[model samples]
Target chain A: MPPEVEGGETTERVLQILSTSARLFATTGYDGTSMRDIALACGISKSLLYHHFADKDEIFARITLGSTRELVQFVESRLPEGAAPSLRIRAFMAATGEYFQRYRWAWIASTTAFWNDPQQRRQTERMLWRDRYEGLIRRLIEEAIAAGEIRPLDVPLAGRLVLSALNWMHRWHKPDQGMPAPEVAEAYFDMIFHGLKR
Target chain B: MPPEVEGGETTERVLQILSTSARLFATTGYDGTSMRDIALACGISKSLLYHHFADKDEIFARITLGSTRELVQFVESRLPEGAAPSLRIRAFMAATGEYFQRYRWAWIASTTAFWNDPQQRRQTERMLWRDRYEGLIRRLIEEAIAAGEIRPLDVPLAGRLVLSALNWMHRWHKPDQGMPAPEVAEAYFDMIFHGLKR
Candidate 1:
């Protein structure tokens, strides 16, 4: 009945539309899902979906931005200020596994295989984790070498490899398979943290 | 000029078709690629392309089967008649990175992302890498621990985690990016073989 009430309802509806769209996209996939599917899944009209998102990519970008925001915030908190090379490296690798479980997004990361193929759409979301964290790992690697914590090697390469190992876990890990998330995180840590060599 | 000429021509054509198809599928992705695309890329007639492989899936299967064979053979050779645990584990991890690089269809391993989705037509091709390599890694983990090479942990989880880390390199690694393959392998090996703790 009132303009303010109408505006509030429209914004709430738009949020509802995006929240549902993201969950579906992350679970099903970006290409596999249809706008109609999102509309039906959301129990909303197509026109209402349009009012919220210009197209699938619009909704996808919004959802991706939302996920990245949470991820950036999580990284900000999980990584402590001025932790040591050994501790920071552990945290860095652990963040990979832990973040996936925390966000429930290994599927989203892997399915879209976001790093490759699409050059520009929503590129900022993909870089959020790497840009925020790789520098820290690079510094830790350099510091660790100087402190004799580990061997001298390229920092960025190691960062990518470590991230790859953690990111790839989403391809095989099924929470329903009785595999504990902490165990996966710990095993990865144990193997890489101490080296598999005796 | 008869049998030998025909046999050589057949094999050449087959190999040509396979390389073209693999490149196309790897670049454009499988769903976006069609018989026409492959044929056009190779400048071969559709009828002749049919002679080389029955369809896209058949060509795709050949690509996968070939990769699986290469990977399995490499690991099997590495696991000698009486090879030591340390050597076997190192060689296994090394071979994995190499094998993943060789195969164009390695992206198929990201099936869980699109598990229930329609593009997952080549599910077997994707799962085979994990099934074969994870089994081999599990055996290696057990042997390595028995031989006092690794910390005590669940073998299966350790194996999957290790494979996840090593094989997932394809996600970020591009040969054109100036990162050498050996260096990448060693970067992982450094973190894995020596660790970061002081």
Candidate 2:
């Protein structure tokens, strides 16, 4: 009896479960958290937890897949279609910041999930979403290079340079403290887009 | 009983334990790895393990602190004495790449250890080392700005931009797989130093 479109209380409970589970996963690591721990933290019974998820992997998959899907959709929506690749790249950073701020815990948990782990790599669907997200950036870089808007560079490496800054934000960028996420993203983008050299 | 000024076999054994533990910690998260697991994985009796490390935190601190110390020393040695900030920054990246590849597991496990975790923050000594490493970069950036080698920008953010690129290397840059680590670092530095814009 996995969650269905039976909105209202069930939806609320599911969201609660997902968020709580995400925090635990983020702090404790995926292999560290158990369904029993999740249920205890969520104030739900084992039976109820089982009713919602087949097991820990199912819960993990649901949370990670959902987060990735939301991120992809959010970034996609922000891109100015048919615009210059540089503009789209800017949008990508801005959108990442907004999305990260809105769902800090889940976003960090999902993105930081160890895809290289042998067990995790088995999640083929999740890997596909990751590829899609990474591919989008690489494609934009390629387009920019082709159009002569940006200097020719290694597309894959270029994509990594842009993403590494945004992905590592959670390490230092405190939410609701210091500069906002969007501005930090903008600053990083500016540094990357315009050379730091005088 | 903890490891002290012992050399020869004792030191070799200690090195072996630290590396094996780093792999487990990196894959399983700090909270997830137990002393028993480490002992079992190392194929040493739990008593012998305890003789070498009082507890998990001590082992963890040893690994992280040692790695950071090595990293700082390596990077510092590479810095051309009194060189321009730009040249020093390049050395920093190259050193980081080389260090990362040399101690791949321990380097990553040490650097990625969650300092933000409340429990981890109590490791004041570890935090100090981290600050020192980061401070070195910040100071270099500040000097560059003062010397007008680079445009004036947020010093802290500039440091993050530089570090984020290096710190996130373990994610995609495989050791001995494709492009060499130093070259990858050089390429990233080039992108940051020279704007992507044509």
Can you write out model 2's per-residue Cα lDDT over A1-198, one digit (the tens) per residue?
Answer: 123322354577788888889888877767677999999999999899998888887777777777777777788989998999888898899998988888787776676676433245546776787789899989988888898889887889989998999989988888889999988988888899887899
Over the true interface residues, superposed, what is the Cα RMSD of model 2? 2.4
What docking grade does candidate 1 earn? medium
Residue B145 miss distance in model 1 (angstroms)? 1.6
Question: A1-198, model 1: which lDDT tens digit per residue?
Answer: 111212344476776676677567666666667899999999988887887777887666655555555554555566666766676666656665566675554236333646332436466655664476566667767877888876766667766656666666666677656645545665666676677666
Two-chain DockQ for model 1 = 0.54
Which candidate's lDDT is highest? Answer: 2
Off by over 4 Å in 2: A1-10, A115-122, B1-10, B31-45, B115-122
Best by TM-score: 2
- Could you report the Cα RMSD, in angstroms, for every candidate shown? 5.6, 3.7
Q: Give model 1's clash tally.
A: 1
Which tens-of-lDDT digit does each residue in B111-144 have in candidate 2? 5576333245545766787788899999998888
Best DockQ among the predictions, by candidate number: 2
Chain B TM, per prediction = 0.78, 0.87
What DockQ results do all the predictions give, each relative to the true complex?
Answer: 0.54, 0.59
